[model samples]
Target chain A: MIILDRRQIEDLIYLPAAATAIRDAFCSTSRGEVNLPPVGHITFPQVSGDCHIKYGHMQGKPDFVIKIATGFPQNAETEGGTGNGMSLVLSATTGAVQAILHDEMVMTDMRTGLAGSIATQALARSDSRTVLIVGTGPQAMRQIESHAAVMGDHLNFEVWGRSASKAAQLADKLGGRFAVRSVSDLETAVRSADVIVTATGSTKPLFQSDWVSAGTHITAVGADAPGKQELDVNLVARADLRVVDLAAQCLDHGEMSHAAVQGLIAGQDVLELGQVLLQAATGRKSPGHITIADLTGIAAQDIAIADVVLKAYRAKGGRDV
Target chain B: MIILDRRQIEDLIYLPAAATAIRDAFCSTSRGEVNLPPVGHITFPQVSGDCHIKYGHMQGKPDFVIKIATGFPQNAETEGGTGNGMSLVLSATTGAVQAILHDEMVMTDMRTGLAGSIATQALARSDSRTVLIVGTGPQAMRQIESHAAVMGDHLNFEVWGRSASKAAQLADKLGGRFAVRSVSDLETAVRSADVIVTATGSTKPLFQSDWVSAGTHITAVGADAPGKQELDVNLVARADLRVVDLAAQCLDHGEMSHAAVQGLIAGQDVLELGQVLLQAATGRKSPGHITIADLTGIAAQDIAIADVVLKAYRAKGGRDV
Candidate 1:
């Protein structure tokens, strides 16, 4: 099996190519060309860590993918420690392992960010320029980089976090490359931005219904597990059009999960992004319509990104690695 | 992360040590000192291939293990193709990956065989000599090798397969080092043997209920998934004492599943081998009692085996990959 380290993956993976592949994966999934089960989880509450296992295959593709990603809340606090991630790509026909990616959650973050970018491309207005990111973490930076790569460099960025200094520091770091500002008030940032992306490990709502603008499209990327919410129940209920990366999973754990439990929206009411990519339904009908895409993430994103990264690595003459 | 090949694993893993580790794993599992979820499956009916993902952790342990194993029934028939298996061991406290074992299902067979050995040690009669292996596959040989390692070399072996030549070939191979014979009549072999191990991919009964003898301790090592039964329903129902590697899983897909569906045995009646290991219950209470241990394989077994293998590798001075 080929072994790929983090540096190799970073050098080989292209976010724009990943976006294209992810779009195709979404279209294929909506067209019933993929076989995937819901994510499997092995939880450890004592150590404050958990692992999520995702496996899937495209109907006629050459390769299938299985990924195990860990989330340890205390990883950053410990020396020489970090959350873990692994992706194994195998032959679809022969079941032979093709590659092992030791990404340490970098691949997960990249795929998640690309999903956010895809949602913005499909649901957000074309004229959208100002972007507000609700958290200043690795995921937020990845999302910004991918969005900039896909949506052009003309867009401005605003960073907001519970810790204002972190938000300002992140904004200052981004200012070296693009137009960015850190806002102390979340409401002013939410009202002014045309697009919003929230990626946090918060247990309560960070944004309310009254803070959002009519033309804004919010891609809530965090709240992957049960009982984690980033948006208020009423905020999700107030969106004119609600979409999700995976409808069943979003209803169970994403930002819209709270709204679902409150009976604010039914599973049938929330559309899938794949359906929108297939043109089977509309994501955002008008510039005046408010849209929310709750992305809990799925296996197809990893499969899509892996396909692109492997192809790129092969083209770069990295053989047997 | 450390990378280990098949050869490394074969040279490092010890079956007797693995048996001891597996017994502890069973006890830990029964005592609720392990964290494991239900096995996750991804099936491809068109290609006749499926992948099983098993992962778990022990309480207060340094590492946890996740294993992904694929079974493509047509792999052996095709050119340059084989099934795949991989295991990732990560630190429980930090979630940092420790090692990757690209075993290609060798670890699976080894652990499975050790489980059978452990079951035999706990349930088989002390005077048992002749052993009947119902199927002449790799797993059958593994069971024989592991059982012989844990038991004694004085016992005789009988090989029984649908293809008599294959069984005779296996017997001839084993005869080089030990006493072995190929038996054509399954009933005669079952009647003459004190311990029987069934490892096959059969969907129906291979041996009848009346073919078994009293005081026989059979370790049914196959029928891990749904619709795969290697032993007759009546044969399983007629066993005086019944045990399973994993009760919930065996009741769902192992030899006892069909019996459970037919209302032949209640779930509570089927005791776990862990209880026997813990001395909470007696296995093979008397020499006259016919015992059956239906092993569907669990994550704990893999975790147990991995821990031993990793420890052995570390002791052998294997460095970072």
Candidate 2:
């Protein structure tokens, strides 16, 4: 099997290529052309660490992908930080492993960042300018970069977090590419931003529904597991257009689960991003309507991006070129 | 991270050492000291293939293991035979992957074989002489070798399968070690053998209940998934001692599932092998009693054998020795 390290993965990865693959993956997911099994998870309370195994196969594809991603919050204090992951691509015909991409969580962040950007571009107003990013972490930076890759760098960006200095550091780190700053007033920033992206690992809602305006768009990516929430339930229920990566996943553990449990919405109330990408379902009914895109990660996205990386690696004369 | 291929893994593995680790793992499993999540599976109908992901962490252990094992029956026609698998070991404290053992299903077969032998040694009558293995797969040979590992090579061995030539081939392959021969009369073989091991991928009972006599110890390792059975429901219900790897997994997918589903037995009717190993439960209540061990396989066994392989790799000055 081909073994590609993190550096090799970064050198081979192209965000635009990943964006296209993810777009196709989103569409395939909604068309029910992907076989996504339930995720396998192992949590270690001693170190506040957890690992997730997600695997899937797209119909008629020559390959399938299995992804292993891990997080250890305490590792940041002692080790370099704890976003580690790898993807295994295997042949659909022979059931033999074809490649091992040890991307060290780079692919995960890129795919997630691309998903957030795709949702924002699809749901946000055409005239939108300012983008607010919550949480000062690796993903926050990725969200900024991916948004630039897809939507250009003309828009202003604001970073907010519970740690003011960290937020300032994050903004300062990314200020070279785009107009960005750290904001202390969350409510004011939430109300003024054209698009808001929440990426913090928070159980409680980050902001109130009343703070968001009518013409704003929100991309929530924090609540990927059970008991995790990012957007307020009222805001989720109040959104005019509620779009999800997958409706069943969102209703089970994503940002929409809280509102769904409270009887605020039904399954039909939300539309899959794939459906919108396929133009089978409408997105952003009007500029004045509030749009919310719940971004819970899925295996189809991993398979798509892994396929992209494999193709790029092979085309570089690695194998089966 | 260290990546050990099939050859290196084969050189590092010792069956006695693996058996000890598997023993500890079984005890830990029954003691509720392991974190075994639900399995993740994906099916590829186009190729008649399926892949299963099993992951777990033993309490207080330094590392956790995630195993990916796949089977493609169609591949045997063009390529080699079907079994393929690998294990990933990661630090529990930091969630960083430490080692990847590309054993290519060797570890899986060994662990399973050791479990069967361990169960047989623990429950079989001390004076038992004849052994019958009903399969012509890789696991069948592993069972023979493992049985000899735990019980010595003095016993007689017989191989039975649907295809007479395949059975003879399997028997001939292992004739160098013990006295082994292919048997066409399965009923007479079942009635005569003191120990029987079934390791086929069958969906129906291989032998009737009446074929099995008293003072027999049967280890059923074939039915590890739903809709697969090797023993008749009557045989499972009639066994004086029905031992399982894990109660929940056995009732859900093992040979015992059929009996439980048909209301022939309940959860309380069976005992965990760990419980029997720990002497917390009885095994082989009487010399004339029939004992059956239902081995559906467990994540704990994977963790155990993977731990063994990693330690051996490191001890040879590979890493952190």
Per-candidate count of clashing residue pairs (backbone under 3 Å): 0, 0
- What digit string (tens of lDDT, one per residue) describes model 2 on residues B15-126? 9888999999999999999999887878887777888888999998999999988878777632224878789989998888888888888888889999999999999999
Please provide the root mean square deviation of candidate 2 (C-alpha atoms, Å): 1.7
* i-RMS for every candidate: 1.3, 0.8
Which numbered prediction scores highest in lDDT against the true structure? 2
Highest-DockQ candidate: 2
Model 2 bad stretches (over 4 Å)? A77-81, B77-80
Local accuracy of candidate 2 as per-residue lDDT tens digits, A1-321: 888888888788799888999999999999999998887778888877788888898988998999999988778642224678799988888888888888888888889999999999999999999999998888888899889899997889999999999899989988888888999999999999999999877899999999999899999988878888999899998999999998888999999899999999999899999999999988987889999999889999999889888889888988641
Across B1-321, the per-residue lDDT of candidate 1 in tens digits comes to: 788877888788987788889889999988988887889888878877888889888888888899888878877642212456878898877777899988888888899888898898789899999889999877877888888888879788899999999899888878887778899998889988899999887889888889888899999988878888988888888899999988899999999999999998889879998999998887777898889999999999999888888889889887776
For the predicted complex of model 2, DockQ is 0.83
